[model samples]
Target chain A: MRVALFITCLADQFFAESGVHAVKLLRSLGVEVEFPARQTCCGQPAYNAGYWNEARSMAEHTLDVFQDAEYVVLPSGSCTTMLRAFYPELFRERSSKFKQAEDLAGRTFELAEFIVKVLGVTKLGDGLRGRKVAYHHGCHALRELGIKQEPLALLANAGAELVDWPASQECCGFGGLFSVKLPEVSLSMADQKISTLPRADYLTSALAGCLLHLSGRMQNHRVGLETTSPYGLSEVRPLASLLWQAVEGAA
Target chain B: MKASPNNYPEEAALVIREHPEVRASVTGATLNFDQNRRKAYSEIDTEAWRVWAEAVKNHLLTHLDGYLRQAEASLVANGVQVHWAEDAEAAQQILARLVRENQVRTVVKAKSMLSEELGVNPLLESLGARVFETDLGEYIIQLENEPPSHIVGPAIHKNLEEIRQVFHRHFGTALNETPEALAAVARKRLRDAFLRAEMGISGANFLAADTGTIALIENEGNIRLSTSTPRIHVALVGIEKLVPRFSDLAVFLSLTARAATGQRLGTFVSLIQGPRKPGEHDGPEQVHVILVDNGRTSVLADPEAWETLRCVRCGACLNACPVYRQTGGHAYGYVYSGPIGAVLAPGLLGLEAAKALPYASSLCGACFEACPVRIPIPKLLLAWRSRAVEQGMTPRFEAAAIRAYAFTMTHPLLYRLAARFIRYLPDQVLDNRVVPVVKAWTEGRAGLKPSPKSFRELWESGEAQ
Candidate 1:
């Protein structure tokens, strides 16, 4: 199947390697992936900040850019949620874009979702064989899209030891503008989620924003993060890169 | 006077920096409540019950005016005097009139958040009546003259040491008194107030329209004494509390008890129709039910936010919220706090008083999950946020920046230009020391930096191929 990769602005700008890995992973699995060069954002940051006019403008732009794609996939669950769930709501008052929004939503999928559900591929060559991994579920992916078991099933079957952090379902507090607006509270939220995390080889998540918030805070807490008893954890990676490594069995 | 929620940033910062104990207490208490609530929900067909409850509340709200009139007629026919309050001041005036008419020198009260909203205690005290808070948690905060921090667990923000200190100052109780000892002391002290008080006040958990019945669910039996022992009893109910039929109590009460405190049933569930009959000698001589509006009608008038009326004030959303756990209730500077408060404060208090509240959450969607009535709280929060923006309540700089970002996103050329321009900026300009937003990020995380190459550039380079 041919697909258009709606590379979210965050993944495109700050974490481009993850997007590259995502493209390779899709191609290796036999699905052709095309990068939509004009796609800027799914309007999440603006929408989240209550700038609907601006968000709608950006969303309208995104609609025009990906109107003809068979399927549009993004590496970030948050942006995918914006495209899939909120776009229709955003366009509901306008009948013209409303149908367009629904059609776009129908074709949009987060990367992991497309792999496990559409590709029907759970195990990936034991690439992560024996590695301990703790996957953080971004709030939008877990709650908005109901994506809980897909990532876990893929990782476990790929020979990774999944460490179940109790607050896996909890938010990492990178709520777009919420991270910068209430930095202290945002930092505190990240602390609460990871303070008791179990020992792991890696901490990964489906969304780049969550990784940025948690990794940023983890950098500050380097002294105290793994200081004592449990919770000996290491560097943070986006889930796409991790999935790609697992599938390709790349060291 | 309402606090400016614009001060939320300073208040939240102060709590995070100076009030570590408050954060600790709130987090512990809320986590405990959340664990029990999740466990309770897991034991039942929670999804089915939530859908049923949502349908019932929606039906009531959709037909609210009719049900409210029906409730008033049924209440008056049941020999209970009914009063309507259009706002807080009106509600306070009604309470003042009642207290003055009855010459109520003392009052024993159940824990009523609505009473707190209307400042019932201070108003009664001003009119020469001594009001006693009989709920142990409410009594603690009452002695300290502080607003309740949580709807259900009012003293959740205070640790035991602070409570002990408050007691030592007022009751000369030993500073080292255990929790059980302190409770016994409060019970012993409140028993006198219940006997001598001429008036009692409570908040209705649910008012049944068909039977004109007031249903109150509480783990403490103080509600029973407050309603029965006093000659005058008054129930201040928000208009949203009405349920259609008496049997509807089965679904609501169960959901309320389980969600609020994880109890199969509260220790006492009082269903009072009216004053005592000629054959009956135990109930109150006069029963008053005041249906207070206080911005509720405006909320009801709202097309998007009226769904918040479905809330039972079970406080599950507060317990499940990460931001509420971090900053505590005082940070919001309002009567309510947490996820529900984020929406309700903006709706009830207006955008100016509560503009910052809606932005306080991470929009994690946990509150939506924890809601028993299935209120889509995050969606409502976004609705309020958009309204706030329309009202020009948000910051000017942020507004301009977001609009510019949107402008860039909408124009492919501008986005590419801006993207390329930012990529070439020196590391010093991108460092936390240089930018305020980055400075905030560096407070708990690493500094922000752009990748060396954009995704479009990677695609152009044929790196993946």
Candidate 2:
């Protein structure tokens, strides 16, 4: 099976390993993953800020960049939501591109959903055996796309011990512009999520913004970011990167 | 504290920074309500009930004019005096006229957010009438002279200690601890008000056109006494509160309390058809139903926003919203706050008046889940945001920044070039917080640092294969 990798702007620019490992994982699964180089941001920031015309301009470019690909996958659920859930609404007035947006939306999938459902490869490796993992359920992925079991299934199959996190469904308050718009409230919300988290070996999420907001705050603006439970995990990375590490570590 | 929708970000920040106590109470109260709602929903098929309720409300909203007409005819047929108010002033004018005609001296009000929205207390007081709030929470806030800090729980921000203090000052009582003691004091005070009050006022939860019935669900018996004890019963209802038939109350009645305060049903579900008939021993002598529009029709005109009218004012959204949990209702600078207010404010008040409200939420989608009617609140927020942008109500600087982003995104080479530069940014710039967004983000969290290599750069070097 072949798929197009839409390396979201955040992952590509800030957390490149997620995209790198996304490709690595897909290739090891015997799936041909193509990185469409001309792709840029998913126009989510603009779309979310209510700048639809600007969003459409970027979305049109993205649509053209991956026009020939069979399926589109992304490491970020938030951007994936922008593509699959909102692009159609953005293009509703442009009858020609509306169908294209809907078409793209149909073939688009988040990394875990793509791996478990589309690729039918649930168990990547047992490298994560005995490793307690606390997965952050990004709001867009869990709600907009209805992705709950797919990522957890993949993590559990990799021999990761999935902990029961109370604030798993809570938002990390990295709501694109909301973080900057209401910084204090955003921090308080992150504090709420962090203070309630269960101790684990790693905290991961499909949406990179959650990681950016959460991992940043966890470290108190420094480097040695540990699990929110104080004496626990010492790493924060995207779900795709963690999955790739699980498989490659075994290899 | 005075706040306005135009300055939401600053107001929210002030609350978060200075008012730790407010944050604690807001968080505690809302979280408790959310827990109750979730537990209540878990016992039944929440999905089916929500879908059914949403469909029913959608029908009511779409055929609102017809339903209003039918309800008016039925209410009139039942010997009810029905009046129409096009705006707040008109509603206040109707009240003013009624008070004059009946020589209304003291008016007792059950908890009505709509009445608060219309600013009726001051209006009645200005017309030489003494107004009393009978609902416990409302009575406390009335004494405090504050707008409701919550949708359902008006005094939710006040701790028991604060309430006791308010009661101690007003009723000259000892600092009360027992709920029953405080309630007894309120009851004694309201009993005298009820005896002397010439008019009773309320807001309806649902109005059934078929039977010309007004349905209200309240845990406190205050609404009961307010509507029944006075000589004149006047209910100021929003035009959106219409149901097709009397039996349809079963669905709303089932979900309203469960969603609001998480009860199987409120203690008292008053279904008043009209004024007391001649044979009726103890009920109001005269009943008046004033259908108030007040920009609801303006909301109805919008194809997408007509769904805002589907709200049942359950306050479930307020309890579930994360932002509301942080800042409480006062920061929204509107009668309604949280997700419904975020959506409803811009529609009711013009966009310019409430420009900042649409952006108050993080679009977490909790409010939509909590809503019994399943109003697509996030979608409405986006719609309002889009309209705001289209009208150029958002900041010009942000608009320019987004345009620049869109430009660079469409032109990938510029994006790649910017990517290369961002990775190599000196620690000083990141630490110094040169950019405003970076400044905002790093206020509490760590500074952002881009990866050394862009994904496209790695892909171009043939590293993936």
Leading candidate by TM-score = 1
List iRMS (one decimal) for every candidate.
Answer: 1.7, 1.9
Q: Give the worst 10-residue stretch by lDDT in candidate 2 chain B.
A: B425-434
lDDT for B353 (candidate 1)? 76
Query: Residue by residue across B301-333, what tens digits does model 1's lDDT show?
Result: 999889999999999999999999998888888
DockQ of 2: 0.67
Candidate 2, B302-379: lDDT as tens digits: 898889998999999999898888888888898999999988998999889998988887888888889999999999
TM-score of chain B of each: 0.97, 0.97
Candidate 1 accuracy as TM-score: 0.97
List pairs with backbone clashes in candidate 1.
A216-B445, A216-B446, A217-B445
lDDT of each: 0.89, 0.88
- Enumerate the candidates' DockQ scores in order: 0.73, 0.67
Question: What fraction of the true Cα-Cα contacts (under 8 Å, chains A to B) does candidate 2 also have?
Answer: 0.76
